[model samples]
Target: MNCEKIKESVSIRTVLESFNLLPAKENRKTAFYFALDREEKIPSLSVDFVKNKAFDFGTGKSYDVISIVQQINKCSVSDALKYLHKFDLSVLEKESVAEIDYSKNYEIIQVGNVRHPALVQYLKSRKVFEQRHLVKELVYRFNGRKFFGIGFLNDSGGYEIRNKYTKICLGQKDVTWIKNGCNTNNEVIIFEGFFDYLTYRMIEKEENSIPDHLILNSTAMLFKVKDKLKVYHKISLFFDNDHNGRDTKKMIQDDHDNVEDCSLLYIDFKDLNEWFCNFIEKL
Candidate 1:
């Protein structure tokens, strides 16, 4: 997506209107004066409403018109214009055909332990799995375990593999698994991705050591899910310290009120699974 074009053509107001967010702004003046049209409400811009120049979002971040546009529209400055031009309002506006209402009351198709209603709808919308081929493969892979299908992205950007017992969705770059078991006292081990869950399960199978697992799912989701980590007694965050992964770690530290010892063993590779595969390769 061309981020720049979308930014120029789109505004905070536009996004709000498109999504039908609360506290709606009716007019351009209201948008500008109330600053409802702004994406990130920094104290500086929110504080000074009259000047409307040199916008700063309070975190020592300043952006001109172009940058502001990019931030608001979620696109690169260069691609903002083109993104806006090609934006399909009708497609985005239409209620997502892939809505996955996971209420037990709803009529969800259950195969063994896995719920396939939402996942099926999402895949159909994205046009990835025609029927049950992928689902069958996924079921076979996970050994017919039950899983709640949260969301799915059929598009070939990432996350193509799934199984019946696995909730296949368009997840973020990394997932933190907070492992905790009743047998163990209060101890937590954070791992990236579900495969790491399998690895931990394999390594400590005999002891059956359980630690609270916190999977960020992605660097972005980590920022959102950081508050959940505060209550834990001891946390050992195992994350890959790559570009996005480093940001994920930093965001966890900066956003959260508590601090935990986060290890970067996965830094040598992209993620824990890669490290696991390499370990097996040597063996």
Candidate 2:
């Protein structure tokens, strides 16, 4: 199989698990596995299922299925392809489709004003305690499991649920907009996540400088907020200091003449919340 066929037909998780390599940390679509070379306490090898690629965060090296096989078997390129030739492509395709489980049903048990102390501490942990009034506390369940988290309501009535370790959503996917930022404001500060918006509120508590706010929640929904964004005359983005964030910032800036990327303000950090917490810690 060619590289493209191997990537499309073979499941990365199936391949990794077949080798008996355990992941140290795992989320819905991403995981951190111990590097194939050494046994380090910190797992620096990151594998992204969505992207169908793996990166050794410790060594800054990237891996595809071919390289992954080559690494585990200590084989050359031809040998890796030769090894893959034995696998059944039909079964691999079925395994890959089963990897993404989005059929989860989350029932909202309660949604009201924020009062939960754990949720409050969660906001504080992200250094966004002052913006608690703008968010709500939600009690939700999935697969008969009960959980509580800080919720930011999106336009579609879905709540963006966040806690110390969890970041998820219920109902629908969309953006969060706060228009009354000092009434009749013509500008809006955009963020990729709600924590960044709260961090902006914490940093700029001044009465006059508070403009509007927009939290995209997910970078995938960045385009969904484009229509509402055009309503504002000026736009400033505080997207994360990553490739996806930068690309989204550029896409918006290229389309709108009055757009500015404010990421330089927190150039060293990944996002506004990270920068705010680090700054507060230093103080």
Candidate 3:
């Protein structure tokens, strides 16, 4: 079979399971299985059922069904496909929409209100302490070690975890949607990160007029939220003044009407949060 046929025939979960690499944990949407070769106290491999792909966040290695078979079995292309041919994959065509979870390799040791002194200080240093209600203090363990960070919940049930030293996502990396009591879909605003959204909450003088918000968290996720974007009568973008952000702005403009690229307000700055912080410095 061709690559496309092969891809359609094999599932990511199947490849991992076929190797007898059982998941250490599983959330509703994702299976936290161990890597192909490496043994660990915690599983570092994340399997996305919705996307049919796997990522070893610990090693920064991504895998597909075929690649996974090759990795686990150490076999050639023909051999891998032959092994994958045992099961009829026709059922996957009508697969259920599973939840996307990212807690595969990490265990939450503690999750509390955003009250950790260091995390609070981190927010203050970024000029977003006032918007602390929008985040959490998440303490999780990975590889037998504990780590904590400021965490924001996205629409995908995963956390956009961040701190001074760590920026990795803690679950299925996805967008965060906020409908702040706007009855009609009159207007909508988009942000690349929660920091920008929180910064806007901190800086925007007009409170009641604030439209709904969508935080992509990562630019690669922009495609997933496009359908949601079409519902708004007016769409405003607050992306960074960088290549990925700028490119995404153009892409959105091509598909949506009444769209505004508001990044020009801080054209010289990197992002909305940067502009807010720098403006505060000047004041």
Candidate 4:
């Protein structure tokens, strides 16, 4: 959307009214303007148009008229303009701001009051997460780690200390491991994050015996992983049971056969770590 069109859509008057900066006299013929040069005297806060533009003097950030209304009314720009109509029946104002439910991202898995130190340490131990490495590490927590890789690193120990030959970066990205064994049996298991892999490793050590598996870095990335699983003969999905995790389970059940959603196995918290701490005491 063009910024100018964004400005024309919102009412400069309603915004001023909300912040208690409306003109002293109610005269439709009067126009409002702010001096961009004097940042201090600018109503302590006002919807500045053109030269000064709309600004939150508190935050020292400026936005177009539309965005200002969007921030204050807690709605999208388009809806904010439309809802303006209801603000004052006397004026011909008309605008509706879309309602949005804002929520803080609560920690689903808690190691302690402070973030786990190993989570950051494990990321540093991998070359892929190094500053020079192209893979930008996103979220590295006790439950999982996310990696954005340019290309899969070759058989380089610098990237992954374990399974160097598999072209897998264990804690860095989503990984799938498959192997042949006695009885020609095939099985598939999925884990949510890298620490869960380490937790599995902590339990199983060198005896990892699940035949084949996939570690989806985040529940949000499950849609992208489904296409790769189509080639496997049988598949089992182990995803977290949080809102997004349940959404991921639904996405996989659409086509894949022999699919087993494992959230029911551990329903104490969001994912494996929370389950490990509060429920699973064997390890």
lDDT of each: 0.43, 0.78, 0.78, 0.45
Question: What are the clashing pairs of model 3?
Answer: 29-99, 102-171
Task: List candidate 2 segments past 4 Å from native.
Answer: 1-104, 181-185, 205-210
lDDT of 3 by residue, 84-196 (tens): 65432543222211332345777888878987655765797699998888898999875555667899998878887876545667867788878878536578888998999
Worst 10 residues of 3 by lDDT: 91-100
Question: Candidate 4: where are CA atoms >4 Å away?
Answer: 1-183, 203-209, 280-283
Of the candidates numbered 1 and 3, which has the greater TM-score value? 3
Candidate 1 achieves a global lDDT of 0.43
Residue 193 in model 1: shift from native, Å? Answer: 1.9
lDDT of 4 at 162: 21
- Please tell me which predicted candidate would have the highest TM-score against the true structure: 3
RMSD of each: 19.7, 12.5, 15.3, 18.3
Q: Which ten residues in a row have the lowest lDDT in candidate 2?
A: 94-103
TM-score of each: 0.38, 0.61, 0.62, 0.36
What lDDT score goes with residue 96 in model 3? 11
